[model samples]
Target: MREVDLDVFASELAEGAFAIDVREPDEYRAGHVPGVRTAPLSELGAHLPALPADRPVYVICASGNRSAWAAERLEAVGVRAVSVAGGTSGWARTGRPIVDGTDARSA
Candidate 1:
């Protein structure tokens, strides 16, 4: 699976890149990157059809591990996916904005 730093992810996001939060629902509810869809790692398969395959998808989790796993799974299915290096934790540490609660879709 390909990987990208949070900054690159952020820039891509700004350009309308698709992103998925592979963390569990609860963890997602606590916080997540703005505009990211909540598709927990456990339910990735079910949501695959809903994800965009034409563009790069940023897969992220609490740390980088889960995102890496998710990215590999997505790539195996022909989706252009990339793991967010350092994941959400790194995003937060770098002072990136986060949204809480459900229904936090991109504006």
Candidate 2:
């Protein structure tokens, strides 16, 4: 599995990379990156098919732990996945704007 710093991931996201938040619904509803899809870690297997294989998928969580686990699982199945270092917290600390509940998905 690979890992990307929050700063680098931000640029990749801007360039159209796919990203999935693996946090639970409540956490995600509080705030998340705009346009990022949600696939809570608990249900990742079911969501796997929906993720694109042609491009890399970036996984993130409130911190990096859950995403790291998800990235490893994805890699085991041959998806080009990377875990976001520092995760969503790092994004907020960097002053990135997050989309709130209106854009959140049910997990």
Candidate 3:
């Protein structure tokens, strides 16, 4: 429903914000924020309990589009979620820590 910058998202994560990567498993396997959980938009409903409602859930993907849509879906289902502006690509470019199958550090 709202937007957040990569740096702000990073700081929020540091402060314990709940982050979710609403991308395909393969895409997420390629790369993602170090602490974000993989909660694909396609199956967000059944996994709603896995998300913490007390805090805002930050959503991200390759770009921000899908995450934005996912944010809307999350809103429809009463979950407070926001799409990070520019998503993972922006996070990567912002020098935030990320993790992949073989790498688990800043990029």
Candidate 4:
């Protein structure tokens, strides 16, 4: 699976790339990159069909492990996906903006 650093991910995000947090709901509620939608790794299969095949999807998790797996799964199904190395923790550590809540958005 392809992997990208937080800087690259953030750049793409600014350009309107789609991103999904594969962490669980509670974990996501704790904090996440702003505007990223929730799609817990547990329910990823149900979300696969809706993902865009034409654009790269950025997948993130607490540290990167879950996002790696999620990225592979997405690619296996023909969706172009990239795992965000360092994940949300890295994004927060870099002083990037984060949104805390259920977000109420869908991808």
Question: What would you estimate as the lDDT of candidate 1?
Answer: 0.87
> What global local distance difference test value does model 4 have?
0.89
lDDT of each: 0.87, 0.90, 0.81, 0.89
lDDT of 1 by residue, 1-107 (tens): 89998889999999989899988888998999888988888888888888886788889999899999889988999999999999999999999888896665421
lDDT of 4 at 67: 97
lDDT of 3 by residue, 32-82 (tens): 888888887777776788877687888888889999998998889888988
Give the higher-lDDT candidate: 1 or 2: 2
How does candidate 2 score on lDDT?
A: 0.90
TM-score of each: 0.93, 0.95, 0.88, 0.95
Q: What is the Cα-based lDDT of residue 63 in candidate 3?
A: 85
lDDT of 2 at 80: 94
Q: Candidates 1 and 2: which is better by TM-score?
A: 2
Worst 10 residues of 1 by lDDT: 98-107
Per-model C-alpha RMSD: 2.1, 1.4, 3.7, 1.0
Candidate 3, residue 101: how far the Cα is off, in Å: 3.7
